[model samples]
Target: MFDWRWDFVAEIMPRLLWATGNTLMAAGIGYVIALVLGLFLALGQRGSNRVLTTILREGIEFIRSTPLILQIFFVFYVGPQFGLVLSPWVAGMIAIGLHYSCYLSEVYRGGIESVPRGQWEAATALNMTRWQTYKQVIIPQSLPFALAGMGNYLVGIFKDTPMLSVIGVYELVHTANAIGSENYRFLEPYTLVGFIFLAISLPTAALVRLFEGRVRSKMGMN
Candidate 1:
């Protein structure tokens, strides 16, 4: 006999909603960290020094090649051995941020590279400083190309936030698991989690696409 209880769903809805806030926080924080750090990584790869570029490139590759869960475990468990004890939230954000940063770095690199060589030449001819070239010319041009990838990873980081539950971050999935265990009913909680994710994700993806179109049109890349 399969049983679905509306009363149980109603009772747990508030708790799940609260946990949804935590999930969104985790995803938002992780994405911000990834966005900033990934930009730095991409810039590092583009720097003049071969040694720094090699090191950054290899480090990005290594992180990208490894499993994200292991990175989370390492930061959570092994960090203490190195005198770097971090709480679950800190560790989860750091691990997720760094993991996604590697991927985002590649996205940034592609975007940066997509900028025509003539633009760099024009910046040089105009006696623009390196920072000025990037700020005024390159980054603006690159944004449209990068927006799609950035949007994809925004959703990706949101989905991956559930992995933080392994270290006890109390995100939506973790809260759902806890609720299911306590109530001895897995069906409703898990179903609600999926629907919640779907609701958020579909709108987010559409908005990203819309934003990307606007950026492209504004930049005359369309």
Candidate 2:
């Protein structure tokens, strides 16, 4: 339906490449934060304190219910009003990271729940503290179970990085849009963005599967 232009692609390649770096940074950094925070969130829901458990469970549900874009806006815009101002990059990272962490929390909870009740009973019989039981027994087993879900979300977060553009974080989609607006060639910019995402996503997803196998094998889960 529209014309394609190699010259325009050539003109925008460098900018797209630079913006790809920003996209990776957002995905990588945000994923790391989500990994750590999600663990705590999952653990908090399992705590013996009923009040704390209820609060955490409800909070995670609320986060999972809302759209991530609103969170990004809240963190970037409303945050300043509450003395929590941050740069676009930082705000987008935190917002998306926190959004995904709630999802990962559910994944972790499922993995944790999959562990045998006998394991918990044995830990109780041995008089291990809950923290010690989780650290020494539950976590090691659960991690392998959780790996596949984690891998899925790893790809998901990378794909979702485009949402950061709404907050003006110069990720791939934002850069492509800028380029299109400048050159009046949406085809080249958008097509390039799709290819770039596909290129990165396919390899990353494969690697995640490979790593999952390695982890499961290493943990004697396979």
Candidate 3:
């Protein structure tokens, strides 16, 4: 009792493609937030203030342990009760970004630790302040190490964008579901979505690997 219809695929292609754009946009926004905030989180864990470091570490661990959907619901549903009302888009982005920031902080910490101890000693010998040492030397060297992990998460966030549908985001899956409900046919739309994801994810993953190689080479990390 299964049938595939090319006509239905064509009829729905435009709307599906439009929703795909929204999906990409959501991923991009969330990724940028994670990139910036994750660095700060990684650094906070290394600070001299023991209490602050412990609290920050615990908070990051808590976020990492919980489900992202729970975080999304908490931000969207619970925040309104606390006078932190936000739109679905805002709530989704904040939740996704914050969730990934914790994961990325671990990645960043690993990258930072990969740098040679001598590098820090050399910076200290030059009388560089902590900020200057991190900004000028450590960050540049650590970035290549982090690049692979960063690329992985970039693809990860893209894949996870579908979770936004639970919060009413009009992303690809959400649109596909709507189209299927309207036509009473899920076969075509859902199949198209799978192929679309395959088409996008394959190339994106390849590009990330390619970009990582280039960054490594440019940093003389090859």
The global C-alpha lDDT for each of the candidates, from Candidate 1 onward, is 0.95, 0.93, 0.93
- Count clashing residue pairs in model 3: 0
Best candidate according to lDDT: 1
Q: List the residue pairs that clash in candidate 3.
A: none
How well is each residue in 60-152 modelled by candidate 3, as lDDT tens digits? 999999999899988999988988889999999999999999989999999999999999999999999999999999988999999889989
Candidate 3, residue 75: how far the Cα is off, in Å: 0.7
Could you give candidate 1's per-residue lDDT for residues 1-222 as a string of tens digits?
Answer: 268889999999999999999999999999999999999999999999999999999999999999899999999999899888899999999999999999999999999999999999999999999999999999988989999999999999999999999999999999999999998999999999999999999999999999999888888875
What is candidate 1's local distance difference test score? Answer: 0.95
Residue-by-residue lDDT tens digits, candidate 2, 1-222: 367777777889999999999999999999999999999999999988999999998999999999888889988998889887799998998999999999999999999999999999999999999899999999988988899999999999999999999989999999988888887878988889999999999999999999999998887775
Q: State the displacement of the C-alpha of residue 7, model 1, in Å, after optimal TM-score superposition.
A: 0.3
Task: For each of the candidates, give the backbone clash count.
Answer: 0, 0, 0
Q: Candidate 1 or 2, higher TM-score? A: 1
lDDT of 3: 0.93
Candidates 2 and 3 compared: the better one by TM-score is: 3
Query: TM-scores, in order shown?
Result: 0.98, 0.94, 0.96
Worst 10 residues of 3 by lDDT: 1-10
